[model samples]
Target: MTAPHHDLRQLQRQAGELDVRLAAARHTATSADQLVTAVVTGQGKLVDLRIDDRALYGANAQKLGLGIVEAVRNARNAARASSLPELNALFGLQPPPPVAGTAPPLPPAPLSPPPQARESVQRQAEPDDESFEEFDFLTDEEPESGGGRW
Candidate 1:
């Protein structure tokens, strides 16, 4: 194959460096109620959480948990949104246009061997002959029927 163009190589190098920087970037957000805060990396990992003491005392456990989850989601969303344009441009990504009132087509099913051919292959791999029957280890005398150990 022909060598890549110098300009293309340069672009790829720049994209790689940008990817490293983006992965290290972090975004933070507080919950709507101002009771929870979360920090998330651009890669969508939650790195830190801070919950106000008032949140624990004033709200039910479930309500406080929900607030924390919401804060993390908001932080991740902000992080992703900030990098989306640059990442898309660097990778030359163009999302498909939306199709109105119709669901996206399903992926095609995987191809498979015919059932008869599959069975034939399995049968060929198995040894049907009783060659092992030549051995007679069960010919030993029967155990004594007495209750006491022999």
Candidate 2:
């Protein structure tokens, strides 16, 4: 006899919905004085930049760029805390994934900054990683759709 009907298509639909929602998320970060801010999409893409009037008075490219990045990243962290309850439940702050049959992902070294932002604050002065504890995604394997989706 044929197997009972059990199409996996429903699982695929759920996976699509999860990815769509993730792609639409946005995070924010701020300067200590709230003078500068940047919004970064969930995918770590810079989305918007906001600067207070005071920030513009004597803004240097280096400082301004740094503030924007920091602010956006800060916001992103906060968003993660508020949003991915399910991911946290599953991963519990585990690091990135690993090869199919290998150990988990190793802690990666910092890479070069984007060419456009040559004068990046992070590039100029290597800040202590402890200072920015926002990037929750990197700290853990953010969950996507269950494998059954595929």
In order of appearance, the predictions have TM-scores of 0.53, 0.44
Candidate 1 lDDT over 1-150, as tens digits, reads 335687688888978887687678777887778889999877778999998888866334436766887788777777666666666666678542243112222232223468898777767765643322133223354334423222
Give candidate 2 regions above 4 Å deviation. Answer: 1-11, 59-62, 88-150
Q: For candidate 2, list the clashing residue pairs, or say none.
A: 28-75, 29-71, 29-75, 30-71
Residue-level lDDT for 94 in candidate 2: 52
Alpha-carbon error at 138 in model 2, in Å? 34
lDDT at position 130, candidate 1? 35
What TM-score does prediction 2 earn? 0.44
lDDT of each: 0.65, 0.52
The most accurate candidate by lDDT is: 1
